[model samples]
Target: MKIKTTEQYNRIIQGATAILLTEGLAAFSTTKVAKHIQMAQSNIYVYFKNKDDLLVSVFRYHQKKYIQFLVDRIDLSLPPTDALRNLVSTLDEFHRTNKESLDVIWSIRQSTTLRQLIPKVSDDQIFIAIFQWLKDWQHQGTVRQLPLMYLTNLVFSAIIDYFQLIDSKEMSPNELAIEEIVPPLSALLFV
Candidate 1:
């Protein structure tokens, strides 16, 4: 099939993500993306220089979607505690609806090659905003004095672990209610 429309670019990224999540990076290739989307392999080169470029694009595509979701659903201006609760609820909502996105993120995170190829996310605008928000919380004595990155990583790491447990069948979302989960998460976030 001919990759004539701009929509093909989106298909390429989606196809690549599906491949990475299902078959792992070892099975990822621009040709595979093309084949997955029923386009010619050469057509993929029209948008990406190589597999690395395509992989990075795929990562950024999903990451931007996630960041946008947070920006839209999480009200950063709320009192810090309320903001954190909204953030947790937003994450749970994301986990329920976009589990494949979490899988794609985890797959890229575990890959050394992808990690090196993907640009740093710390400089992303929403990321900086979150970091600054953490700093403000610290200033207000809303959270501990630990380094911002440490606190951020701790929360994100725990979220990832929670998702992984669900993915691995060690935990079931229906078995535990969101109300059952919120208090402990709040305890962790607040001083």
Candidate 2:
């Protein structure tokens, strides 16, 4: 598998996502991903060292894309409170639009083998940026003066919980609207 253009690399990652989503991690392999994208198995090896590397790469690729999406939509010039709101809203939009990718991510996190490869995927660049923003807000007295880890969990847990509720059919569409949830989340996290 000779080196090639970026598109080819993207195609491999896309195929890997599809395989994880449809086949579960137990069935994931370079061979399957290669077959999924109609490429040679060795080609996947050229880009990724092994199965775990490929899985981690796929997760990182999607995570970066998701973070970029939020960054592009969020207005950094706004006050911290408003910017946090924008971040939450952008996250909701990203989750809605990228459900399958999100599903693949969730699946990867749940897999014991893959989870070990990138145990702290949440600590990636996107989260570091958000954590820094939160710390700045705390310093400015805009957000509550809590441990950054607790604050990060508070906001992210709410978002994840809301998605789980919707996915489990525990919350009806109307009940889970961002407008209905963001206010409470804002009150809970912001000063």
Candidate 3:
């Protein structure tokens, strides 16, 4: 087995994450990651048990970054409208930055087993901030009083559907159509 220096280990993991983000998890392999990092395949084995373990680590790393983005963007003290707008902007930025990985994430969601493997914003502490903001909005009568879980899942599903529509090349709807529909759909559930 080739033992990697600490820096080399981090480099390998970073390279592995790039592969997953660009090629999707299905195409991500330890050998490819090692090659990207200019390290031996055995060096990766020194840091990870196997490809599955490495993929999970990479998924967790990106998920945590996304959670941080949301946390930094949302101000619980702000009015509901402002908070929601900020949240949307944060998500738009995330989707824009990881467009390829986001598409891959959608593909992974098709596999129920894989969905379990991917970490979620809800599972992170930052999402608790969102929950608190929602509760505050409900108390102020600015938003609906539905259970947070119900609303969360509802919004999540709607957003996923919107992305799917965009991903479906054959459907060929204009971008304006999605932009027009998504806000109202989210607003209906939110308020």
Candidate 4:
């Protein structure tokens, strides 16, 4: 097993995700993952040190994929309200599409070992784009002139809680959509 470029490294991560999605994380053994990618388990060792490394890589890969999915689907040219709607809706759609992956991600506790394995994506980078959109609405007097970072945290906090509730089975997706998601977000951003 020889080390190679970033793309091959990513493919191993992707292979782990495919196994997790189909077989559930409990069954996502390194041998099974190697078979999924048509490689030897020894080959994976060349890239990821062990099972935890592979799991963390998979989580990071999925996070990037989720963000890119939203980036691709969202319309930046739209007005603030419309653009915000598109972004939120894209998140909702992502949760629906990758529910299992999200479940696995949430299951990973923020312990030192797991935290060390996971890569960091800055919250500021994600929110800066949102703030730029909100800036246009603020100028038009459609939104309040609040601190962009604060507002960004507020919105994502709500979204994360919603996902947690859904993941816990405390709220069904329909309840989340009608009772929690659409109404409250509308009030926060539009009203």
* The candidate that achieves the highest TM-score relative to the unseen native structure: 1
- lDDT tens digits, residue span 14-106, model 2: 999989888888878888888889998987777888888989999888877776787678775677667767877787898889987778778
Question: How does model 4 score by TM-score?
Answer: 0.67
The alpha-carbon RMSD values of the candidates against the true structure, listed in the order shown, are 2.5, 2.4, 3.6, 4.3
Residue 61 shift from truth in candidate 3, angstroms: 1.6
Model 3 Cα lDDT, one tens digit per residue, 1-191? 45458787668767976787678656778988888888789867788888777766665656666667766766657555555556665666677676655654455455566667676557657556667667777787877878977676665566566656666664444644434544675576566
Q: Which candidate wins on lDDT?
A: 2
Q: Which ten contiguous residues of candidate 4 have the minimum total lDDT?
A: 119-128
lDDT for each residue of candidate 4 in 1-191, tens digit (9 for 90 to 100): 47577987878877887887688656669999898889878988998888987888777766667667777787857866566667777777888898765655655434456765665433423556777776677778776677766777677778878877877799887765723454566567653
lDDT of 1 by residue, 1-191 (tens): 44466788888888999888878888877777778789888888888889988888888888888778777897878887677677777888988898777677667867887887775657655567778888988899987888888777766666667777777989887886544555676677679
Deviation (Å) of 159 in candidate 2:
0.7
Better of 1 and 3 by lDDT: 1
Clashing pairs in 1: none
Q: What is the lDDT of residue 72 in candidate 4?
A: 79
Name model 1 segments beyond 4 Å from true.
1-4, 124-126
lDDT of residue 101 for candidate 1: 79
lDDT, residue 24, model 2: 84
Clashes of each: 0, 0, 0, 0
Assess each prediction's global lDDT (C-alpha) against the native: 0.78, 0.80, 0.66, 0.71
lDDT of 1: 0.78
TM-score of each: 0.88, 0.84, 0.73, 0.67
